[model samples]
Target: MEYICSVCTGAYILGATGLLDGKKATTHHLALKVLQEKYPEIQVISDNKVVHDGNIITSGGVSSGINMSLYLVEQILGKTAADRTAKTIEFVH
Candidate 1:
């Protein structure tokens, strides 16, 4: 695939085609290298606890996905709502 030519673009090629262009995102650290090389337009920030570039939000790893998801929930429903969801999901961090 042209999109994943550089890295493991296969991971999110569909997402990229649909929503990743002109946005920011990150993938699993193991997939970082290829992502960077393949998608130079994407701001591949490896240091972010959670990378949010407009509509494209990418987490470093599975654990980070929880954080990002909570952040989104908090944004939409406020901290109280997010906290409740986190608690319901048993997400500690």
Candidate 2:
């Protein structure tokens, strides 16, 4: 199954489960240092709003979840569907 983490802290939960080991991930900018310190095995991305590695996807914060959701939609249903969904929701991206 695929895992999508909507918030920074959610990545911590996945990390604890060893799902994020050796994977690229991200969290809230403020917590980036903490995440790296806690999970040295994870390559914490400090600049990305969303990070996708394998079947797990992690977003920086609440707002980035929107991007993550759109990405998931595109991945599973294709870009046309994702674009329509974004437009229907009045989301700019």
Per residue, candidate 2 scores C-alpha lDDT tens digits across 1-93 of 566565767888988899999999998888889999999999999899889898889998888889889988988889999999999999988
**Local accuracy of candidate 1 as per-residue lDDT tens digits, 1-46:** 0122112233267345746666667777887777777777766767
Model 1 error, position 57 (Å)? 1.6
Query: Model 1, poorest ten-residue lDDT window?
Result: 1-10
How well does each candidate superpose onto the true structure, as a TM-score? Answer: 0.72, 0.92
TM-score, structure 2 vs. true: 0.92
Q: For candidate 2, list the clashing residue pairs, or say none.
A: none
Cα displacement (Å) at residue 87, model 2: 0.7
Clashes (backbone N, CA, C under 3 Å), per candidate, total 1, 0
Each prediction's whole-model lDDT (CA): 0.65, 0.87
- The segments of candidate 1 whose C-alpha lies over 4 angstroms from its true place after superposition are 1-11, 14-18
